[model samples]
Target: MQLLRSIGFFHGNILLFCVTTGAGIFVSPKGVLKYSSLNIAVSLSIWAACAVLTIISALSLAELGTTFPRSGAPYYFLKRSLGSSVAFLSLWIKFFIYPLGIATQSLIISTYIIQPFYTRCPAPELPKKCLALAILWSLGLLNTRGVLTVAWFQTISVLMKITILCFISLTGIVLLGTGKKENVAKFENSFDAELPGASQIAEALLQGLFAYSGTSILINIAGEIKNPGENIPKALITVLPMVAVVYILVNISYLAVLTPQEIISADAVAVTWMDKVRLPFIFGSIAISLFLILTPMIHSPKVEYIYGFIFIFSGLLGYRLHVHLNQRSVCFDKITCYLQLLFNVSPPEDQDEGISTGKKHLEEIFL
Candidate 1:
């Protein structure tokens, strides 16, 4: 069974960059500002600190990923280093967490999409949930085609997102140079304001960390990446710092255009920045939609984890019941097939051989 190694170093790096520096940049600046007692400098500092910490974590995980280079990275790492139960638990937790993240991002996208249309009345909740499911299933199906399709989609979307950010940052820089004294004065005064408490600072850092959370995504699809050993680490090191820089610059852009108080009060900081700059509503909505789309697409590879966990758990339960009833055996071919699908590998030429191999592995752990 051969998996496609279609994702090159460039695509891998861009994917990691997009995933780690997500829609959080659009919303988190406001949260950090508000929670850190409206201190713009402290919020930006926390963002930088978290980016560094995230880079360190990415480096460590890159070593592990390149060494093992498996499709289900966390599962393989834990299974070999600890045991099967720990690996299984990790998959189980990821099953819930990843989908929840996708759903949350989808809902956010739906809200932003409907915001302009529903200005006269409250947007309906059912349509939002429906749109979320639609987006989830559509992306899941797109991923099932092959790794190449997913990689290309991620690369294009990420490039577009970065361009939008660059535009926003440049707009801020231009505005700053042209006598935007009101917000500049407020931003300058903020540097001398009282600093936030340690707990408040910690909370702000956590928010930044959450924004930088997807740096390890390359590891999840290690088997499908071209030259995993070289590309995995290269992508991580290349993208993490770059993403950190983008985050900091974007936050500065937000502060440059709007005062700290304006940012803290903004429901969506990027949109607010756009409004402050008097950009058209259509362009703002497009940027917001792109951010929403890119955020969930970061988790696209994890869709397999959901199916993998279900099949493994069911197989284990069937095995237990067979043992209790003293039956001859519980079939394990289904488990083998599901695992191959989960890893996006073709089935072996000999089905019996594949099932026997899988059954032996499970028997060692469960029997």
Candidate 2:
């Protein structure tokens, strides 16, 4: 398969970072409160673990992508390794997961945009569905036109969000140090050693886990990568540590600016904190909205056009690694020999004769 020579390492990694940190500014405080009851160490530990898991998963996938270099990553991996049933099931999950996640974030972004105009609009009847559909379909059209455009949009959005976060973090920390008469009790209480209840721990962990959800976007573009093995893994590794640091620092800033109870009391912490500091509620809402919707949309092409490429790449790599770790199987050798003969040769090998021919034909329809 031929990849468009548009996106390079910087563009790809920027998108990955944005996707990895998408919407966390809005949801993370509530998650942290639930788990550790304001215990900074526990909350930080949970976040660190999640970041590590994302990195490790990406590393394993890196090896797979290097060896296989196929499209439809997850789909390819499962299908080749397990069988058709598992492969299809995995693809089905991918189909639902990405679209639904995008739709849900879109609705939230629309709400933020709408809130400024219609402060009196009832929460239950925000009419965000229509707005979400518009954004979703618009982005869909953009992606269908070309993925490079999507990557550029993602990079810009990410820069915008980072600027907002840095501004908020810096101002909040400075304000706190000035001995302002704000409620600093709850944030200071995070150092207390009272353990949280089991339910609270579960809820907080779940929320933190969501922060790591989009790390797989790296896998989506595996086939198009300049060097799938090195580039993909390197991007993931770089993004994870950066995300972890940003998350921890942002939370600290929130704690410094407003008490923990204040963050938890509001429906959206980032906006509420911004509003507390005399920032316009409208501006805060808009910033938060863009962070959620814009970041995730950057990774949609993989979900839409080449859904399973990363998985396929990963699976092939896994098979190769398995052979390296253990003795090579005769079955594996025979399958590869037959696949090479049919797919790479002129008189396609029996089973390969039809499948390889069919795949080439299908590519024409999509490309």
Candidate 3:
């Protein structure tokens, strides 16, 4: 039986937008501001550059999606275009790395969602973890219903996010117009802050790049995308720039209302912005689970080489693990699913033929 291409442009747009706009938009403005050495001009420039890269990445992924027309996102494409080893590495990352991010985002949402009750000290971990688990389980149940069900939820969520972000932006613009230009009062002196060194700039760029992190997520479900050639590009072209503009405008609003010091100090930049204006709003988030991926950049200087080595190591590690496992007849995916169950991570799904190909290469190389 074949899968239906039920995910049309509308759903695709939601997926792209919602995945790409995560807690980063709310939180990373501070990182962007901080890493850029508190320079507003440098901060905005980093954002603009990231926005352009987002477009480029989406367009490139569209070409690849249409060309491969495969499900399992990078898993299949990397196998076919590059090799099984590379694809196998992505499978490992999907299983291992993604779940950390998922948990982080969930906790962020839980924190913000429960913040109202505490209103003073931090929310206790027990309640926060319970709420996060409830949220994760609820979404897990929703996913079992099918793609469209998930898409519809994303649609509602995306609309709420856009609305709040727009509210923030418009409010900032109004403040600027009304002469409450706290950060941008003197536009001429905006660039007066000294630029940081290369390491700091690179760190700032990473912060900015991650701001557009999940745009490539559509490729994960590329096979489900209706008319991959047309709809993929259309959805990306339609949504990303709009997100980019929102990000910039929101940043401007933050600068307009809150000073750079406040931006850097706040726990959540958006939350702080809202608090400053006394805008009573707190919406549930599914995207805050995506920010944990930023940790490696902060911890390592040789990140590029580290990433390359990890992929190579994953291929070798996968091969060795598969060889030792007694279930020679079972596919690698079934084993992955078992691991998922144990970890409370993304539970395994039925995979396509491409997944088997990863292990097949190891079989050929060994036997």
Q: For candidate 2, write residues 1-367 as lDDT tens digits.
A: 5875455678779878878767655676666765677676677677777667767876777666666665567677777899999988887897898888888677767766565544333344446788888998998898897777888889888998788777776776676677755535544545566777778777777778776678777676677667676777778777778877777667767777766567777666766666567654577799999888667667664454355567787888877777667756656655655575568754445877778765665454445
**Which lDDT value does model 2 have at 139?**
85
**Top candidate when judged by lDDT against the true structure:** 3
Evaluate model 1: give its lDDT.
0.77
lDDT of 3 by residue, 1-367 (tens): 7667899988899988998887678777889989998989999999998899879877887787778776775677788788999888878877987787778778878877876666556678899999999989998999999888899999999999988889999988888787744545745587787898899888987888877878877777887888888888888889999999999999998988788898898766666776777642322222333334445556665658688779999988877776766435455556655565468575226455545754564465446
> What TM-scores do the predictions have?
0.71, 0.69, 0.73
Backbone clash pairs for candidate 3 read 73-220, 101-289, 105-288, 105-289
The true-versus-predicted C-alpha distance at residue 204 of model 2, in Å, is 1.5
Cα lDDT listed for each candidate: 0.77, 0.71, 0.79
Question: By summed lDDT, which 10 consecutive residues of candidate 2 come out lowest?
Answer: 117-126
Output the better candidate (1/2) by TM-score.
1
lDDT of 2: 0.71
lDDT of model 3, residue 123: 70
**Best prediction by TM-score:** 3
lDDT of 2 at 104: 68
- Across 112-184, the per-residue lDDT of candidate 1 in tens digits comes to 5665455445468888788878888988999898877777888888878888888887776676677667647
Task: Order the candidate numbers by TM-score, best to worst.
Answer: 3, 1, 2
Window of ten residues with lowest summed lDDT in model 3:
280-289
